[model samples]
Every structure is written in C-alpha cells, then in structure tokens.
Target: MIITFITAPILGRLLHPSDFGLIATSAPIIGFVTMIQNLGLTQAIIQRRTITKGQTNTLFWLSLLLSLTFATGLFVLAPSLARYFQEPRLIAVIWVGAALTVVSVIGEQPMALLTRNLRFRLLAVIDIIGIIVGAALGVAIAWYTRSYWALLVPLACTRFLNLIVAAFAARWFPGRPVWDEAARQMIGFGAGLSMFNILNFLARSADNLMIAKAHGSVALGFYDRAYRLMLLPLTQATWPLSRIMTPILSRLQGDPEEYRITYISSVSLLMLAVQPGLLCAVIYSDATVALLLGSKWAEAAPMFACLGFAGLHQTFTSTTGWLFISQGRMRDLSIVGLVSSTSTIASFAVGLPWGPLGVAVSYVISDYALRLPFIWYMTGRAGYVGVGDIYRTVGPHACGLLMSASALVLIKASLHAPSLIELGGILAVTYAINSAILIMFRSKRRLILQVLKVACRSVMLHRTSRKGRF
Candidate 1:
C-alpha cells in the first residue's frame, strides 16, 4: 500500500492521463467478464460451513473452465471494444488483461482455501509482495518505455507471481473433478453472489465507461484518478475488513446476538479506521491531488472532493457485504446491488453533460440518497442487525466527520493560512477535536486504545525477539 501511494504520483507525472483513462475505459469489460468467470463460486468456498473434497474439486474445475472461456472472449472482443472506445491501442491492453485473468483464476482455489483455513499471515505476505513488486515494476517500465503496456505487463506479472506464491503458500492441490448435489448447491450460492458482483462491477465501472465514451480519455483520466483517490479509504481499510469480516462473521452466524454485536462492533472499528482519512481527503482534496498526482491533475480536484463526500457514505455501505455473504443472504445482496447499480448508472447519465465534476457530485448525491438507505434497509432485513444498530454504529463517526470538515473549513477561511501550513493546522485541529469526541465515547475509545496497545506490543515483541536471536 505504501509503495502504491508513493508510486502513483511518479507514474501520474510520467504517464499521460490518457494512459490511465485508457486502462479505466477498458476495465469494465474485464470487470464484467471476471465476475462471470468466477461465478462467485470461490467465495462460496469460503462462505459454506462445510464442503466435501468432491465439491471443492468440482468447483475448481468449473472455475478453470470458465476462466479459459472468458479469457478467449476477452482476447477476441479486444479489437471491437477498442474500436468502440475509439482508442485502437486498447486492443493490446485488453489482450494483455485477458492473459492476466487466466493467471488470476488459477490462484482462486488455493487462495480461497487459505482464507477458509484462516492462513491470513501467508495471505498478507502474498498480497504485499505481489503489489509492491508489481508497483515497482510498473513504475520502472513506465519510466523507460512510456507506454500503457507498462501498466498491463506489470499487472500480468503480479498475478502470475501471486499465483505461484499462493500455490506454494497454500500447499493445497485439486484432484479429479466430481460434480454432485453439493456442487450444485455451491454453484447456486456462487451464481447468486455472481449476480450481485455483476451489478457491483457495473456500478463501479459504469462511471468510468461513460466518462471515457462521452468526455474522452483525457477527461476520463482526471475522473478516474479522482475516483481512485476517493476510494483509497475503501481500498486500504474497508475492503480488507470485508475480507476478514466475512469469514469471521460466517463463524458467528449460528449465534444471532453474537453475530449482531460483532457486526456492529466491527463496523464501528472500521469507521474509526477510515472516517478520519475520509475527512482528511474531503478537507484536503485539492492538496491531496496536487501532492499525490501532481498539478497536471488539477482538473480532478473538484471531482475528488465530490467523490470524497461519497466516501463517507461508502465507508458504511461497503460493509454490507459482510452481513449479506456471512448470513448467506446472497439474494438480498443481489437485489441491493441491482438498485445500487441502477442508481449509479442514472447518476452518470445525469452528470455526463456537465463533465467529471458533475459526475462526481452526482455520485455523492446518489450514494447518500439511494445507495445508503437501500443498503441500510436491506442489510437490516437480511441479518439480525437493524437500522437503529447501523445508526448507533455509524452516527458517532458521522458526527466526527462533520466536526473534521468544519475544522478544516474554519482553518482555511478564518486563519487564511498558506496551503501547507493551513493543511497542517487543519489536520491538527481535526485530530484534536475528533480525538476528544472519541475519548468521550468509552466503547470506541477502548477499541482505539486496545488496537494501539496491540500494535505497540507486537513491535516490542519483534524487537525483543530480534535481540534474543542475536
């Protein structure tokens, strides 16, 4: 993650916005195809309470077959998609992405097995190593080659390396295929989840697709960067929690009260982890874009801020997956996904004429207006958790978000400080105010302090272990 944060600006400055835009434009096809390819069967592997070796093997073979089929479709469709986007160069990009998908699905079962067995340390190492190496490789290639292939090649290599590493780390192998009633059940679960993911992929990629088509690649480049900037909290914090939470939540499913309590508590900690960052991004959107992607992306500033506002809503709503998947409520999740996707696509259409900033603003409005309420209501209906529980979990962070936003605004307007100094002052005030408010919340305060202590002890133990080894 640190490597990615550091390298994004360097790549942004080195590569054209068109380059990123091209990637963004071509991404939806891959996203949609991959969702189909997986059939969400892999997640079913993790979600199910018990699975026979035969069921696992059957799913594995099914996954491999679908992956091959989709890779071929992508490779064949590359030219037409490129023509549609009016970026002929996208042909190669799509082709490379096709190969990458084949490599990616190869790891699905092993990785899923690792998740099922709770081998998170190995998963963490696999993820960190794959991304760091991939980012470094992408930066180096882009520096020298100045080509979009730089991005594509590194991505392929990353997945390739991840497959190799995960295979070894997981130490699990699939045997002969066995299709049975259990396989049918697993596929049914996976197909439902796949439906949800298909909607999710459309929601995620529709904005980028429309921006690229209507406004062209340059506009897409800015919007894409802005959107990614907004999603940093989701990627860095909330998404990871969803992974850890789903499996843990699945375990707690039999105990409704415990599951409810745990879900609420986890969401609280997730907000604690991500809310301040979202606040900072919303407050410092321009500075952040300037600092991270360089001044060349100044067009993305307004869009970034708008998207940052959406991030607050996203921080809470993205966690709905935990409740849905853990509770085996994929049908409900799929319905929510349909509504969310429809709302997002409509926002893109409404916002298209005004450009990326308009799209960004519309996204925030749609999220809060449509997606948030839908998710809150749907998850409540699906699980033991309810709307009041969500309010109790998220309300404090929502207040803290408002407080942080106000502090930053006051610092900018009243103090009239310079950019760097003003940002520092805003951050300090936001931190102080939010910290005070959190300390007043005894439960949240305890969780924060507990996490800090665990981190400190882990560091101390590492140091002592090193000394003893010496």
Candidate 2:
C-alpha cells in the first residue's frame, strides 16, 4: 500500500492518462489469459487435504503446458487485439503481458506449497522484495522512457524474481507428468474453480473494456486509477487475511463450529480495521486523489468516491471466496460467480451510456442490491456460517461507518478547501472517532483488544527469535 501511494504520484506525473489507459485496456484480456494459465490448480493444491508427489508433478506439467499454449496464443493474437481496440500501441503491451503469463507459472506450485504450509512470513518477505525492486525499476523506466514499458517490464521482472525466490524457498520440484485418480479428481475440482475465476475476471474487467471502447483511453485511464484507488484498502486488508485464513479454514472444514467462529471474528476484525478509512476516503475523495495521484487526477475523484461506496462492502465481499475455496464448495462458488458476473456486466452496460462515473455509481447499486445479498445467501446456504451470521458480524461496523461518515461530513463542512495537511488531520480525526465508537461497544472493544494482544505477542516473539538467531 505504501508502495502504491508513493509510485502512483510519480507515475502520474511522468506518464500521460493515455499511457495508463492503453495498459488498462489490455489488462482485462491479460488478466483473463493469466487466469487460464493457472487453471485453478493452485487453489486445489492449497485446499486438498492430502496430495501425492505424482499428483503434484502431473499438475505442474499440465500447468506448464497450458501456460505455454496460452502465452503463444496471446502472442499470436496481439495484433488482432490492438486492431480491436484501434490502438496499435497495444500490440506490444499485449505481447509483454503474454510473456508475463509464462513467467508467472514457473513458480506457481512452489508458491502454492508455501501458501498451503502457511509460510506467509517468508512469502511476505519475498513479496516486499519483489514489489520494492519492481516499483523502483518502474519509476526509473517511466522517468527515462515515459512509456508503458515501465508498467509491463517491471511486472514481468517482479514475477520472475518472485518465482525464483519461491522455488528456492520451497525446495520442491516436479519430476515428470503422471496421470491417476488423484490427479483427475484435483483437475475436476480445479475445473470448477477455473470457471468461477473466468466469470469473476470478466465481471471485474468489463468496466475497463467498455470505458476504453466507449470513451477512449484517456477516460479509461481515469476510471482505472479510481478503481485501483478504491481497491487499495481491500488489497491491503482483505487480501492478506484471505491468504492466511484460506488454508487455516480449509483445515477447520471438518470442525464447523471453529470455522464459523474463526471466520466471523476475523471478518469482524477486518471490517473494524478498514471501514472507517474507507468512509474517510469517500468523504474526502478529492483530497485523496490529489494527495496520492496529484491534483491532475482530480477528474477521478467522483469516480473514486462512487466506487468507495462499493468498496466498503467489497472488502467483506471479497472474503466470501475464502469460504468457498476453503470449504471445497467450488460448484456453489461457480454458481455465485455466474450470477455475480451476469449482474455486474449488466450494470456496466446500464451505466456505460453515462460514462465512467455512471458505471461507478451503477456498480455500487448492483453490488449492494444484487451481488452482495446473493453471495451472502449462497455462502451461508450450507455452511456453518449463515446469512444472519454475516449480518450480525457486519451490522455494528456498518453503523459505525455511517457515524464516521457523518462526523467527517461535519468536519469537512467546518473546514474550507483543506490542504493536504488538513486532509491528514481529518483522517486522524476520523480514525479517532471510529475508535471511540467501537470502544463504546463491548463486544467489538474486546475483539479489538484481543487483536492488539495477539499482534504485540507476535512482535515480541519475532524480536526474541531474532535475538536467539543472532
């Protein structure tokens, strides 16, 4: 998140909106191809209770073959995609994305092995290194070339580096392809997940495609940045939790009571951590855009604010996947994806006539009105956790969100066109208000304290371990 905030401003200054748009235009297709490259086997690797060496080797070889095939296909289709988008520059970008697809799969099984074993600390270190190096290189390239290669090259480099580090860390390698019942079953499971992923990607990326086609690259760039900004909190809060919890929850699948308690509490804690900040961003979207991406990006503020409403719920909504994947309910997950993708696409179409802001507004409406409820219903339908459980967990935080928004509104009204410093102060005040409100609730206060205690203990343990190592 810090890297994002730092690099966004630098990149925004060095590159044009069209530069971002061109890349964003290719993102949906690139992302979709990347999903095909995975074929969901990684999730299967993580979710399966037991796996044989033969099965892992088979999956690895299959993944490699698929990655190569798709990469070649993408490389071949680059010019066609550029023609479709009517932007010849996109051809090279798509080719780079195709190469990234191949590099990404080289360490897939190793990374999945790390995830399954709950080696998140090492994973975090690897990610930090990859991101820092990638960000620095991207900035340097952007400064020198002012081209979209900065974006594409750094991403490819990061994936390459991460895979190399992951392979070394895991110390596991595939032998040769083997076909057996275990491999077949895992493939079946992965098929469902892959379907869900395809639909989900389509839903997520449709907006970018439509905006780019309808309004052109410049408009798409603004919308893309706003969408990314809205996702910042979710990426920081929900992503790590999902990664940590998925394997843990998968282990707890047999113990429904524990799974229910664990998932609900973690989600509650996540909402408590992220909700207030999202509210502040919604209230001060302009300031956030100015601070993070420069004043030149002021055009994206309304879009960002509109998307922030959806993001408030999106943080929790994204975690629903953990429930699906961990519980091995891939079919139900696919059904949910089908519904979500259909509605999300419809929403995009409904709003495209009004441009990007309209799309943002429509997405929020569809999310709250259709997608969120459906996903909650489906996830709770047969699980230890139910819809009522979700409502109860998020209810108080939702109330707190309203209160925080109200407080920020009052604060904003009293201030006149506050500067960046004032915006920082407002954020502080918002968090303080949220903390006070949360403390007023006994249950939430207890959870907060419990989390703090665990955090402190982990820190102390880390320090002690470091001293012993030295």
Candidate 3:
C-alpha cells in the first residue's frame, strides 16, 4: 500500500491519462481471462484438508494446460479486442497480459501450498518484493517509453519474479498427471468457485467496460484511477486478512460458535481499520486528488468521492468470499455472484448515458440500495453468522463513519480552500473522532485492548529473544 501511494503520484505525472486509459480498457478482458486460467484450483488446494502428491501433480498439469490455452487464445484475440475497444494500442497490451497470465499460473500451486500451510509471512515477502520492483520498473519505463507498455511490462516482470521466488521457496515439483478421485473432487470444488469468480469479475469489471465503451479512454482513465484508489482498503487490508483467515476459518468450520465469533471480530476490526480513512477520502476528495495524483486529475475528485463512499460497503462485502470459500459453500457464493453481477451491470447501463461521473454516482446508490442488502442477507443466511450478526458487527462502525464524515464536512465547510496541511489536519481529526467513537463501544474497546496487548507482547518477546541470542 505504501509503495502504491508513493508510485501513483509519480506515474500520474510521468504518464498521460490516455496511457492509463489504454491499460484500463484491456484490464477487464485480461482480468476475466486470468480468472479462468486458474480455474479456482488454488482456492481448492487451500480449502481442502488433505491432498496427495498425485492430486497436486494432476492439478498442476491441468492448470498449466488451461493457462497455455487461455494465453494463446488471448494472444490470438488481441486484434479483435483492440478492434472492439477501438484502440490499436491495446493489441500489445493484450499480448503482454497473455504472457503475464501464463507466468502467473506457473507457480500457482507453489503459492497455494504456502497459503495452505499458512506461510503468509513468506507470501507477503514475495509479494512486497514483486510489487516494489514492479513499481520501480514501471516508473523507469514511464520515464523512457512514456506509453502503456510501462504499465504492462512491469506487471509481467513482477509475475515472473513472483513465480520464480515462490517456486524456490515452496520446494515442490509436479510429476506425471493422474486423474485420481481426490483430484476429481478438487476439480469439482474448483468448478463451482470458478463460476462464482467469473460472475464476480463481470460484476466488478462491467463499469470499466461500459465507461470505456461509452465515455472513452480519458474518461475511463479518471474513473479507473479513482476506483483503484477507492479499492486500496480492500486490496491492502481486507485481502491480506482474507488470505490468512480462509485457512484458519476452514480449520474452525466444525465449531459454529467459534467461527461466528471469529468472523464477526474480523469484520469489526476491518471496519475499524478502513472506514475512517474512507470517510476522510469522501470529505476531502479534491485535496486527496491533488496530493496523490496531482491537480491535473481534478476531474476525478467527484468520482473519487462517490466511489470512496461506495468503498465503505465494499470493504465488508469483499469479506463474504472468506466465509463462502472457508465453508465450502461455493454454490451459495455463485448464486450471490449471479445476483450481484446482474444488478451491478444493470446499474452501469442505467448510468452510462450520463457519463462516468453519473456511473460513479449510480454505483454508490446501487451499492447502498441494492447490492449491500442482498450480499449481507445471502452471506449470513445459512452460516454460523446471520443477518443480524452481520449488522451488529458493522453497525457501530458505520455509525462512527457517518458521525466522522459529518464532523469532517462541517469542519471543511468552516475552512476556506484548505491547503494540504489542512487536509492532513482534517484527517487527524477524523481519526481522533473515530477512535473516540470506537472506544465508546464496550466490545470494540475490548478488542482494541486485546490487540494492543498482543502486539506489545510480541514486541517484548522479540526483544527478549534478540537479547538471549546476543
């Protein structure tokens, strides 16, 4: 996340909006194909309690074959995709995306092995290295080439490096493919997850596709950047948590009460971590755009603010996948995905005629009016956690966000054309208000204290261990 913050502004300055727009146009198509490339076998590997050598080998070969097929298909379809988007630049981008797709799957099983074993620290190290190097390369490419290749090439490099590193770390290799019973079961499990993933991608990417088609690349660029910014909380915070929790929750699946308690606490903690920052984004959108992406991106501020509001709900909604995958409830997840994709695509259509800003605004409205309620209902309907549990967990934090947003709005209103310093101060005030509100709730206070205690104890233990070693 820090790396992202540091690089985005530099890239914003170095690259044109159309460069980003070109990449954005190809991203949905690449992302959708990438989803199919995995066939959800990684999640299946993570979710399953037991796996044999033969099963792993079988899945590995199957994954390789699927990836090659899709990569070739994407390479072949590049011109068609470019024609569809009416952007000739996209052909090269799609070809690069194809290579990236192949590179990414080369070590899927290794990465999934690490994940299944709960080696998150190792995974984090690999990912951080990949992202940092990628960002650096991207900046250099942007400085030189000053084109969309900067964005595309770095990602492929990162994936290639990640695979190499992960393969070395995992110390596992695939043998001859075998279609054993266990492999078949894993495939069956993955099939359901793949369906859900495809649908979910459509729901998420429909807006980008529609925006690019109707409003053009420059408009799509602004919307895409704002959308990516809005998604930072999910990408940085919730995603990592989901990775860690999926295995833990899968282990705890037999204990209903424990699963419910664990999930609720996780959700509460996530809301506490992200909601205040999102609120700050909403209240200070223009300043944030100036600070992060420069004044040239002033056009994205309203869109950013609108999407920032939507992100609050999305933070929690993103976690629904954790519950579904952990519980082996992919069918239920698929149903929810289908519903969400339909509504979200329809919402995009309704907003398209009005341009990207209208699409952004409509997204916020639809998330609150349609998507959020349905997601919460479906996710909680049959799990150890229910609808009421979901509400109670997020409700207080939502209230706190609302209050903080109100206070920040009033505070901003009182200040006339606040500088970057004032924006910083406003963010500080927002955090203070949220912290105070959070402490007012007994459960939240307890959770906070418990977390602090754990953190302190870990620090002390580390120091003591270092002293002993010395």
Return the top candidate by TM-score. Answer: 3
Each model's lDDT comes to 0.82, 0.88, 0.87
> How well does each candidate superpose onto the true structure, as a TM-score?
0.95, 0.96, 0.97
The prediction achieving the highest lDDT against the true structure is 2
Ranking by TM-score: 3, 2, 1
Candidate 1 RMSD computed on C-alpha atoms after optimal superposition onto the true structure: 2.0
Which model is ahead, 2 or 3, in terms of TM-score? 3
Per-residue CA lDDT of model 1 for 359-445, tens digit only, reads 888778878887888788888864689888887777777777777777778766665424766666666677677777777777778
Q: Which regions of candidate 3 deviate over 4 angstroms?
A: none
RMSD of each: 2.0, 1.7, 1.3
Clashing pairs in 2: none
Assess candidate 1 and give its lDDT. 0.82
* Between candidates 1 and 3, the TM-score winner: 3
